[model samples]
Target: MGAGGGASATEGDPFWRRAAWVAVLAAAYFVAGRLSLALAFARLAAPTIWLPAGIAVAAFLLGGPWMWPGVFLGSLFVSAASGRTAWVAVPIAAGNVLEAWLGAWAARRFARGRAAFERPRHIAAFAFLSGAASATVGAVIGAASLCRGSLLSWDGCGATALTWWLADAAGIIVVAPIVILAAMERRDRWNKEKSAEAGLLFASVLLIGWAVLGGAPASRNYPLDFLCLPVILWPAFRFGPAETALTALVLSGAAVGGALRGLGPFSRGNEIETVLLLQSFSAITAAAALAVAAVVAERRKDQEVLQGSRRSLEAAVRERTETLTKTLGELESEIARRGLVETALERRTRELAHSNQELHQFAAVVSHELQEPLRKILTFGDLLKGMAADPRREEWEYAERMEDAARRMQRLVEGILELSRTTGDAPPLGPVDLGEVAREAALDFEPLVAEMGGNLFIGPLPIIGADRAQMRRLFSNLISNAYKFRKKEDAPRIRISAESPQRGFVRILVEDNGIGFEDEFTEMIFKPFGRLHRRADYEGSGLGLAICRRIAMRHGGDITAKGRPGEGAVFAVTLPV
Candidate 1:
């Protein structure tokens, strides 16, 4: 219970403080309102300019509706002090309060919020709603009050009400925006440059207003009213809305005061006409100046925002460029490292290829040297076997075996030499008729085929880029192997056929009806010294097919064998066309 009481007291404190402030502000408003009415009132008890109307509206918009009671109390005091009874003062005060209320409502509705006057649209809206529209309501009500109280004649009521409306409108346009804009301006200390410019503008406005509106009694016919426009535009172009609004208000007050005293360019007509003309001039000048100043302020803000965005975009681009440059540097370093590795690999390949070539040449030289010794051994054994002095059968048989062994050794050496030559480099390739090469190889093996009672067949073949000698050797070895491996009971039937199986390559199949081996030994037959039959059985050095395989490889082609244990063997050779 004690805590609740304390909370209530805390909340009540602000309310009491607000009430005290409202009372003080109302007293101040009443004093200022009475003073403005006394100074600007015409003979009909209507003011040519009502400054308190502008003050009331500015207060409500800036301080919010909480200050409305102060506006009401001030209007009531001003009306009663102007010599109206309670009944008359009451309605006139109500009209004044309604005027401020309507103006605040219109500002919040149309101007979007409190009138900062930073844009031309905001200024124009305030002029139409608060200046022109709200002032009409107060004029109508105040004029009717004058008629009800018998203070103004019905005949003069129209002109007096018009004067009242123009005065209120002029006051709102000239004063309200100035007070609102000043209150909202940032609390920055003035620099030397700003202070100098502001001082010049203030001096110019004062001098022009004095010359145009404060004319001497004898010089009332002079034409100097339009000279105030440059002075009004000076602050609008240089400073901003706040300075422009204030300058216009000061000029308007001077002009209206002069015309009321019958001393300015608008003083030629009746008093009401003179007041209306001055009000019209002041209202138009203030509206135009405020609008131009708002436009200048809005443009400056847009330029600042645009410059900030450009700076941010430039900064982002610089950051992205720096990242890309670093990435490119990394990629270049990786490429350099790979290039060095490739160079080393190529050098090693060339060295290994050179070593292989030298080894092949050494084998050929060794085989050629061994052939002479084997030939001498065979010749000596044959001469010994034919001698008449050795009549023993066993002795002749031993001599025969010795000669055969020597001849076999000589054949082995020759086969090695031929194999080495096939593996080494050959002549460059050219366009040669493969069919002609096959036919020639078949012709050379014709006598051997007849001796073995075998048949050989050759097919048409494409012309290809190849070494012709290598192609002939390749076909010769295959045909000879076919005759050598023939079954004893069956005559060998060899067929050679060529066909283009795919683009850029041709396949030639050499098939024979011979004593074939197992499929597992197909790859083994292509190795050096690899053979399917023994030397005693097939009379070979086991290098025939090996040499054929080497020849095919050197020409960028390959040979593969397919066979069954009792069926014929087929060798398929694929070469680039």
Candidate 2:
């Protein structure tokens, strides 16, 4: 076999491995035979019975097809050295060769991944039966052919065959799994990580039981949950199942060894006792191992479910918290806007009030000082009218002059007072029935509406938080204007309704189809004394919006207008709920 290629050893190297195996097999047989003879010489030649076991174990460890010739040759050498004629030794030699060959065949075909003595059933299946057959066949054939001098009868041959089979089987079951396990134990694979610890723990249950505790307790008739089984399961649970399974097998073999070696009460005796003990031990241990596996697997499953639940709950809480925080931020921004609007309104109100105060003071002064002079002019005009003979022209001219001068001062006083009285002592927050207010406003304008051939319709409304007087006045002003500004060519229609969309506010809308103005004048029309139409076309103090806007501001709300030219205009007033 060309089994070499410098750095990369060729596939042929396994031939060398096979050759080395043969050599070791031959040497072990020869040495064991010599040792057996020495033992035979020492104890007055009584068979102490460890010799055949040595023969079988050596062959089991090193035997293969190529090792057959080596074992046969080694057996021949043992006969030559023993000083016993071929008649006494050649049959033993042939039996050894046959047993070794059979073991090697079984191992090559079946024991690649398994340890020596890995299963009692496997031993019962191949190791025992194969060895028994090899030993019986070789012994009967070799004894008949070469042992013509010994007193070997059928009974003696059968006893010897049974003994040989037992010896061979003991070696195979006790030793092969261990050797196979060693071969499988790569340092890189079997390092003492958690898995390794688990393996060692499992294997140690048998080893330690054999070394320390000796064997299964004499009192146990069936499998009980052993302390060691749980210990093995702990690592098996944490590390993995493969390590645990392998370890369990190792321990099982150990348990068998302990039972067979006669160190405990449960040690092998008759064939029946030996088989039952082995069967029971293997079945119980395997069942316990399986039970541990089931529990550990379930624990891992539960852990995964719990971990998923925790993640889902945390995600839900995080999402809910984020939504709540966003809503709070929006509310805070709205509050800030309200505060800004209130500040601006306060400033503007103060300015308007101050201007009105100044105008009122000036009007008071004018009223006291200018009115007496106007009265005296009227008196002189009357006197002139009485004194003139041609009275129609003189009286008409004097009266017209007096009336024009006095009317200018009266207009100034009234305009000043009306603007000043805009905020005539309003009440604070209270419950206002908006339905009642709308009805009252509609009633106030009903007579005017009939006169103008216009209609005002009120819709459903809700009770809201507000100043009752202010709300009533506000509705009344809007209805009065709706009827007051009817077009000559078309019938005026007004619709009023209330709706609450905002959680914190109520909205009341007054819609109308009338002689609507351009939208550009919408903002300008809300100022004090601001008018969109000429006085000849429509008459008003133009303070309607100013009052509406003031009321809305007082309630922390607003009024907005949306419309198209000549279609209709809608006034939306939002009041805090």
Candidate 3:
């Protein structure tokens, strides 16, 4: 209809393509104008229905505001060809462009453009604003232009303006709807059943129109025009707005032709009066039919949406119900399995507790019995040594050697007993100031450190949660080891410093500048009876570090060591703070 045929005739289109579309639109407009003029009562004025007005409005609505040039050129050509001067034709052309623009703007603003027929309120808006209201623009401008150019007398101007307005309004009401609806997207596809029904409906409307308003004389005078309404409404109810508008256009055309031939009920008066009556009837019928069709369409759409929602909800409920049923079955099975596992675990726990208690008792009994035998041997050996005469004698040397062996045996037994005690049930934890404990351990080593001229530093330490006796023993053993394994040339410089490495834990480091061991012995040194040096060289039961690690672990902490052959060793003990 317009330069772009849709709302795409913007500046972005190629110049040559847009010009081609403009030419097509102008040609269509001029043709429609010439045909509508053939139906006019006056040469320069009153046409019963100006079809070009509807074409111009539809073109603007479909192809956008850029269709103004086509409307202008077409209107100008029609006005000049109808023998009007430039003074009249120019204003008339301008008036036509304004009418098209105003109608399109109002339809888009108040109605929904091509979609206006989908709802009753939008249909009413298009009929009133775009049809009745916008038609006044061209009527007023064209009438004034005719008067100023001396083509129409002042007194006759009112009648010409009224005719112009009514013709344009009728054109929009009857013809614009068909054009717009044709261009719109079809909501319902064509099927054999629907197509047959639509054909039947149109045939029925034509029959009823021909009978009431355009048939033989006997059929027209009985005021049977009211019977035509039901035929128009049939399409509105059975089909949608597009077909409803089409049916109304068909009936209106029939009525107009009958009135022009002076054959229908509206042919009682002059040609102008008969045409006015027919145009009025057509406009009112088309508006009512379109409004009724829109109402039906809207209700149908809402029902469809409601049915879709109900189906989706049912599907979701069914899916969730099935999922929950399977989940409940799995959960019940898991509960039964867990009950059996918990019962077996409780039985194993009881067995383990009994075995640990018996083991502790055996260690205590064995250590006591062994210590008594060693003590008796040492005491008898000492008495025998005293009984010997000379210290250098063979029996005296044998007695001294026996005493030394017995003392070493006693020490080993005591060390084993201490190690067993650490493995037993742990003592209750308390807030122990590790600073005070480290300082106390340092004090215990003071006599040895002073005698050997070695330095022992205890830096600041945090208060922690631990077994007080275990913590004390842990530090003492570490300090004792540092001194025991001192380098021959360098003094044993041992440092005890503490840092909170992370929240809720403190790392107390015991660093020694002494003859450190190899890295391979790091983990082995913490095992029970694990020794990195020969027993004859370093006097230890090889359980000091093992005891230290066990105590740290029982308190939910741990001990780690790093060392080189000559560099200092650092033993980091992490305790909860």
- Give the distance in Å from residue 414's predicted Cα in candidate 1 to where it truly belongs: 5.8
lDDT-best of 1 and 2: 1
1-577: candidate 3 lDDT, tens digit per residue: 5532234455467878777767777887888788778766543367777778887888788777787888899988888778988888899999999998999999999999878888889989999999999999999998889999998998889878888898888888777777777776455677999899878887887887787777656785487877887888887888888788888877877776676677777775676677678768877888999999889878888988888988888889988998999899899989989988898898888878778877977887899899988889988988888889689999999999898888877877887888888888878889899889877877878788877888898898888878888889899999999988889888779999988889888898999998898999899999988988887888887788999999988888999999988987999999877
lDDT of each: 0.78, 0.57, 0.83
TM-score, cand. 3: 0.60
Q: Tens digits of per-residue lDDT for model 1 on 441-484? A: 88977777777787898888899999999899899889888877
Model 3 clashing residue pairs (backbone): 6-63
* Residues 1-577 of candidate 2: C-alpha lDDT, one tens digit per residue: 1111122222244877666655655676567556544422131111212233334433444333444655676777776774657776666666666665666555545543133233334434444444334445544544453335454554355544444344344334333333333434332344558566745675666655555324655534533335455645654566443344445545544544555455443455554344344434443443344345446655766787899999999999999999999999999999999999999999999998787667756655665566577667667766766666464685667676676555554444443343334444345777878988889878867776667677777888888888887888778777766666556677788899988868988889988886666878788867877877875577565776777777777678888877666767788899888
Better of 1 and 3 by TM-score: 1
- Reference-based TM-score, model 2: 0.45
Prediction 2 global C-alpha lDDT: 0.57
Q: Best-fitting candidate, measured by lDDT?
A: 3
